[model samples]
Target: MVIVGSTNPAKLEPVRRVFAEVFGGLEVRGVEVPSGVRVQPIGYEETFTGAHNRAKGALRTPGASWGLGLEAGVEFNDLGAWLFNVAVVLREDGRTGVARGGSVLLPPAVGERVRAGEELGPVMDELVGQKDTKKGPGAVGILTLARVERVEFWRHTLELALPPFLRPELYPLE
Candidate 1:
């Protein structure tokens, strides 16, 4: 069984979906556990910290043969606005694997608003003259979207990260 260090349906659901789709028919189980990490990550290490810590911590728990963690955060850029990236961590034994997805650019106005503590998604919604809608690349936005929702999009994002972590043959979006 692979235990995920997140209880958020937003994070867990996609991890499960993508893993299943990518590794279906394999004897793998997807389970959710609390990550104990904040949602809005602060810095570069924090970007990888929440997810890495969760996976490492989950391994300490009982009944977890494998541990996984997913973390997302916005990084300030010099251009205009910020960029959001998602990190995925998978661990078993002393070996650890990490995977990351492409970034989503946040508009400057929206980025500044979010920097003040407002939620990114909700704030972008208001600015785009919509409500409760995702701005920027959205769930599957900036990357490749196969007509999936935010959760499903996240699922694929993690899925993409997994292969690289698991095999030297796959080096990520290089």
Candidate 2:
């Protein structure tokens, strides 16, 4: 079975779809878990740490053969603040894989709020006048006019992380 770290539908549904597509017939379940990082992780390193921590925590579940963690965060560079996601997959025997999702440039106003210490989900909710936007189409979907849904966006990243599992001979546990 595959255990996902977050109970959020946005995270769980994509993991379910991607794992089903790649591994076939695996049971997938979500369990709420602490990320061990700031609620709004600001940079790539911090975001990756959160994903890694959650994956490790989920792996401790008794029947989990694989643990999956997905985390989204924003990063500021000279150009602008970009929002992105990271996925970490951990196997029971300690083999692991990690991949990052594509980033979308946040609108200046949204970036400002996030930079000022607001979590992106709430900021997005306030901007879009909707509740729990993160668990649905997400900022990318909103910004891209549904050109990419949250599930599709995350599925690509999660699928990228599976190469290590698919070809274990090439990706020896490290």
Candidate 3:
């Protein structure tokens, strides 16, 4: 069985899809778990740590052989503050895999608010005048005009992370 770290449907759907496609017939379940990071992780380190922590925490679930975690955050670079997500997979045997999803440049105003201590979900909700856009099309979908839904964005990252698990010989369980 696979235990997902978040009960959010947005996150759970992707894990269900990806695991079904790859592992087949495995039961996928989402349970609420602490991310061990700020609600809005502002940097790569914190975002990655959140993902790892979630996966690790989910593995504690009974009868779970796999744990999945997906975390979204914003980071500023030379270009601008970009929103992205990181996915982490942890197995009962302690093997791990990680992959990062695509990023989108946030509007200056949005970045300002995020930097000033606001969560991206609420910021995006206000920008598009909607409620909980993060759990739906998300900022990427809103900015891209539905060209990329949040589920697909996260699925791509989860797919990438599976390579290590798929080919254990290629990725030694250091």
Candidate 4:
């Protein structure tokens, strides 16, 4: 069984799809867990930390054979602000694999608000005039006009992180 740290459908569904394909016949469940970081993680470090913490928290789920944590954050650079997601998978034996999702440059308006202190979810909701955008298509989806939903965006990250688990001989556990 696999326990996902967040109950958001965007995060939950993708993990379920990927795990079913990678480790056939396994069960995936989403459990709400605090990221233990800022509501809007600022940069790569904070985002990765949030994901790592979630994976650790997932260990508490009863009968969980593996834990999956997905976190998205924004980084402001000279050009503009870019949004990216990190995926972390933790196995019972202490092995872990991490991969990052593709990033998209946020428009100036959204980027400025995120830089100031607002969470991306709310900013995106207002921009899209929707209620809970985070639970469905996220910033990437709205910005891309639904060309990429959150599940598809996250699926790429989860798949990238699976190579290590699939070929343990190539990626030896320390």
Q: How do the residues 1-174 of candidate 3 rate in per-residue lDDT, one tens digit apiece?
A: 999999888899999998888889999999888999999998888999999999988999999999888999899988778999999999999899999888999999999899999999999999989999977988899999988888999999999898888999999976
lDDT of model 4 at position 6: 92
lDDT per prediction? 0.60, 0.92, 0.92, 0.91
In order, what is each prediction's RMSD in angstroms?
A: 5.2, 0.8, 0.9, 0.8
| 26-107 per-residue lDDT for model 4 (tens digits) | 8888888899999999999999999988988886789998988899999989999999999999999978999988999999
lDDT of model 4 at position 53: 88
Shift in Å, residue 39, candidate 1: 3.7
* Candidate 1 residue lDDT tens string, 1-174: 667776556666666676577666423334454545455665456767777777776666667666777776666757655544454555554555666665656667777876777666666556556554542345344224435456655665576666654585555433
Q: What's the TM-score of every candidate structure?
A: 0.68, 0.97, 0.97, 0.98
Residue 115's C-alpha lDDT in candidate 1? 75
Segments in model 4 whose C-alpha atoms lie over 4 Å from true places: none
Model 4 alpha-carbon miss at residue 98, Å: 0.4
Evaluated against the true structure, the overall lDDT of model 4 is: 0.91
Task: TM-score for candidate 1, please give it.
Answer: 0.68
